[model samples]
Target: MYVGIDHSTTGIKVAAIGDDGELTTAFRIDRRNVETAGAFLEVLDDRIGLSRVSLATVTYAFGNAIDEIEGIEDVPNRGTTDLVGLDYGTGAGATVFDRLYDSAVPTVVLPGVHRGLDTLHAFFRHYSALAGADKVASMRYALERFRAEFDASGAFIWVCASSSCMAGLVCGGRLTGFFHWVGPVHGWPDPEAVRRGVESDFEDVFMRCGLLPRRGADLTDVHDIADRDLLQSVYWSTLMNVYALYPFARDLGADGLDAVVLSGRLMRRERPFPLGRRVYEACVDLAPVRFAEPYTSAQGAALVARDVAAGADEVLGIPVGDVPGGRDR
Candidate 1:
């Protein structure tokens, strides 16, 4: 079995896949619920039986410390240069990484799209980092789905709007660039919020910059929100983000996107409105649009483990390092 771990903003997601490329099981553990590495490992064992895991691929915050996929034990500081400006989630992901590092699972750590990544366009170097490793994994999964469903591949854009909103461009199956939003609805803070952060502190500002909390909505259940105005704001904000990146995708010389893939928690909601369908309808003029499964990142990471164990030297243009026990087939 191949295992993948996604250390995301809300929780840590684990997914398992068999050698036949079929997902066997998947689950998520909230960041706050993690007490210790050992405790989390015990839970994981109970859920997926770690002893049977052939190899595991893990993603952590930022992923800027390295540029290529590497073994867990070889990565430093859990694959991040610094956590000063990052929103570390109760140290749950860090604990998970430490545990996997010490274990004999032969784990592989994936890198986030940052200025250091050579596959990215030159213009995107303005920011130190673009998206997390989970976003890359999500895009990888989207590309696979696109190829399988459409029987064609060229260029595509991935928009993930849930706790926050982010979009990336993938041309010829490689990540080219990303649109970074600094607004209340995005994970990053806006200029006004940055000024406020400087005035007091950034930690408080970063935590509250997300859309739901900024609009005083409950984060526990987005579908249960009673405020129609807030829902509209979220829908428009997500669409605008996609629209903002459409021109770039067309002008990147890929002759327009083959499709626009949408994912994230908000994409899965269907209460007040079908968020994913609405977004897809709005974007149909730009290109065909589709939705990715909720566990895309974790499942994509599982695919990475499967391919790397099969001797794949690269995934989505990101070079792979020596796998601890990977075969050279």
Candidate 2:
């Protein structure tokens, strides 16, 4: 059996893939009450036997270290990137990862895709950063969905928005580039800023920009706002963040992408929510749009675990290495 774990900002997601290569058990552990690795494992053990997990792959916040698939012990900082604004569940992550490491299961950790890490290049790139392997995992599933549903051969774009918005390009099975500058923290870029081609440090922008908080919000106030101006403005900001990557998905005068993967919180398991529905409506005119849930990262991690246990060298084009070749973005 293989195991995939996603230490997302909101929860700890775990899945167990049986020998048949199908996900047999999956569930999300709410981070609200999860304090220790033992508690985390206790919940997971109830769903999928850790003893049955021959090969396990885990993804923690940021995932900036060790670009390729590598053992958890091999990575420093628990696969994080600078640890800036990543205090969501650091202790929980350490506990889960530490327990996983001590387990008999041979576990590997994956790096989030970032600009400095290895990936295909294009005319467009993130200002200085891209995203984590979570986006890449969604793209991997998007590719499968396109092949299975569209029956077409071409590249696609993944527009992921939630606490933040990010875009990734996949062409010919290679991750070409990504856009993280306009993520939620990026808020909506001013028209003059666009005209000026204004640029700034991603961390600074992330701290100050974006239309909404990446995490918790007092939806009560959001629900009580009159005139609806605040909602509309933030809505536009989110749209802008998504559209910023449309051009990067294709070359000039191109027909556009084969499909659009509405990812992150806006979409899930081929399901599209309100924001995701709008993105689909807005982009369907250009090409088919499918909602590929962001949680596929865990599934992708399972795939990684499966393949690695089977002796494969890569997972959906991401290299496997004990150490990454470049610094984390």
* CA-lDDT, candidates in order: 0.78, 0.61
RMSD of each: 2.5, 6.4
Best by TM-score: 1
Show pairs that collide, candidate 2: 112-132, 112-133, 113-132, 113-133, 184-210, 185-209, 185-210, 186-210, 187-210
Q: Report the alpha-carbon TM-score of model 1 versus the true structure.
A: 0.90
**TM-scores across all candidates?**
0.90, 0.76
Q: How do the residues 219-252 of candidate 1 rate in per-residue lDDT, one tens digit apiece?
A: 5644355555665666787787778777766666
Assess candidate 2 and give its TM-score to the true structure.
0.76
Q: State the lDDT at 198 in candidate 2.
A: 44
In model 1, the number of clashes is 0
